[model samples]
Structure formats: C-alpha cells, structure tokens
Target: MQALLALSRAIDRLNTFVGKYSIWLIFAATFISAANAVVRKVFDTSSNGFLEVQWYLFAWSFLIAAGYTLLNREHVRIDVLNSHLPKKVQIWIEILGVILFLTPVCVLIIWLCIPIVAERYATGEMSPNPGGLIRWPVWVALPAGFALLLLQGWSELIKCVAFLKGLGPDPTVKADAKSAEEELVEALRQHQAAAGKAP
Candidate 1:
C-alpha cells in the first residue's frame, strides 16, 4: 500500500506539472491561430501552413495531456449508476473498463496509427497548404499519447486489484484538501473553454 501511494504521488506530481502547462499550450495555440487569421484578413500575408499548425497543436494538446488527466481523476465518469453498486461490483466495473475497454482502445489506436504515420513520414507527405508548407509529423503524438495512456492504465489496474483486496485505490496518502489555487485554475479553465477561448 505504501509503495502504491508513493508511485501515485510521483505520477500525480508529474500530472500536476503536465496539467498546469497544458492550458498554457492551448493558450499559445489559440494565440497563434488568431494571429494567423488577422494576418491573412488584414495584412493578406500569413503562414502557409497555419491551419495545419492549428490542427496539430490542438491534437497534441489533448493527446499529450491524456495521462495527466487520468492521474488527477479529472476524466468524466459514468458513476451515477456505478456509485450505487456494491463495492465488489464497482471494482469489477472499474477493472473491466480499464483492462478491457481503455487499454484495448489505446493499444489499437497506437497499433494502427504508427504505421500510417510512418508511411507519411517515409513518403514526406506535405499538407495542401500553399508555399510547399511542410508539416511537423503528426505521428509522434499517437505513439506518445498511447504510451502515456498505457502507463496510467497499468497503474490503475494495479491499484484496482489492490482495491479488490480491500487495500483501496492507489492508497492516496496525501491529505485531501482542496486548495484555493486549484479551485481558481479550474474555474478559469471552465470559463475559457466554454467561450471557445483558451488559457
């Protein structure tokens, strides 16, 4: 239990770092896109591959932050029903979801995307953007994202098995206090996302 708690703490600290900066990346991407738009409309001179850059930034932002979100327990949960189930049933559902569903999905995506990205890289596929604008490879994100998901999935599986044995989830040893800083950050994120804004 202590070992699990130590591991979870390490991951959570790493998660805090990842999650904190993820918003900043989103902000930077949004700024880049807005600047590109203004340059095109007002100055009539903009990046040739700005649109593709936007897509890649958005994609990378979401995918790269996947594991951190899991570590924070911030992912959506269909717990209205599960919350009412017995402890054993709850563990089973969680185990099934993590092992059978989440892991498989990530594995399949990684398996499928790696080769596609390789083909693209090998052939030097360029975006349709003007000026022969070259694209940074989108392939890197796929394998990286899946790898993070896989690690977190393994962590969750271990903790869940311990949980089934009544050892509890990740043995979160930290005191559960909601800090003001956390609340403020969350509030701001919600506000920005809702307005199609980023920060």
Candidate 2:
C-alpha cells in the first residue's frame, strides 16, 4: 500500500511538472502568432511554418496538460448530480469510472496511436504545405498524452482504493485550490479595489 501510494505521488509530481511548464507553450504560441501576423502585414509575406508551429504548440499544451488537469480534479464533471451523492458512493463511482472508462479509453488511444506515430516517423511525414513542419512530432503527442493520462488514471485508482479502505484521505474531497476562472475573477476584484483606493 505504501509502495502504491508512493508511485501515485510520483506520477502526480511528474504530471504537475509537465503541466506547469506546458503553460509556457501558450505564451510562445501567442507570441509567435502575433509575430506572424505583424510580419505578414508589414512585409506582405508569410510562411505556413509559422502558422503551423502555432497550432503545434497549442496542441502540445492542451494534450500534455490533460493528465495534470485530471490530477488536480479539474476535469469537467456533473457536479449537480455528484455533489449530492454520499462520499462512499462518490468514491466507488470514481473507482469504477477510472477502472472501466478512463483506463480503457486511454489504453485504446495509446494502442491505436502507436502505429500511426510510428508510420509518420518512419515515413518522415511532413505537412502538405511547403513550409510547414514535419508531422511526426505532433503525431507523437497522441500516444504520449494518452500515456500520461493512463498513468494518472492508475494513480487516481490507487487513491480511490486507499480512501475506500480507510487508509488515505477522501479522494472525492475538493481541493481548496481555485480554478483559473476563479483566480482571474479574484485578480480583477483586487485590481478594482486598488483603483478605488487610489483616490
């Protein structure tokens, strides 16, 4: 049990690190996109590579952060139905969901994507656009992302089982950490308060 918990914690840390750094990809994508637009407007020219790279970065960020999102319990849920359920029931549902749905789905995706990614790499596939980037890097993300998700699913399953066995904290309990939207709202409120105080 201790070993399992340690493994789960390790997976959590890995996903956390990936998620934190992946956020920078968004800024990179935005900056590149703006730069592309500026160059296109100023020089009356553009490269498909720049546009494609932005898409690649966006995809990388979204796909890589999926496991981290799950780890933080930030994935979308039917809260209206779930919040009213008993804690034990909720834990059971989580266990079942991870075991039955999340695990299988991620596994299947990883399985399917492996061959495709291999083919892309073997063929050295490049985008149809003349200046666009190679296709394999983006193709590889499919299996890589799903593998991370699969690992996180296993971690979540362990936590759920531990909770049910009374050996760990409640897995269903919401963390105190605020959502991005909530954080944004709080920041805006603080800015407004500061402006009012400026007078």
Model 2: colliding residue pairs: none
Question: Candidate 1 local accuracy as lDDT?
Answer: 0.73
Per-residue CA lDDT of model 1 for 1-199, tens digit only, reads 7687567556657656766777876887898899998899999897757767677777777887898777666677777887788777876777788888999999999898888887887888787757544443666787887777777776676677787777764322223645789889989989888889543
Reference-based TM-score, model 1: 0.74
How big is the positional error of residue 98 in model 2, measured in Å on the Cα after superposition? Answer: 0.4
Clashes of each: 0, 0
Query: Candidate 2, residues 1-199: lDDT per residue as tens digits?
Result: 9999999999999999999999999999999999999999999999999999999999999999999999988998887987788988888889899989999999999989999999999999999998989999998888889899999989999999998888898767556767789999999999999999996
Alpha carbon deviation, residue 141, candidate 1 (Å): 1.3
lDDT of model 2, residue 42: 100
Which parts of model 1 are misplaced by more than 4 Å?
A: 1-14, 132-136, 168-199
Q: Candidates' TM-scores? A: 0.74, 0.88
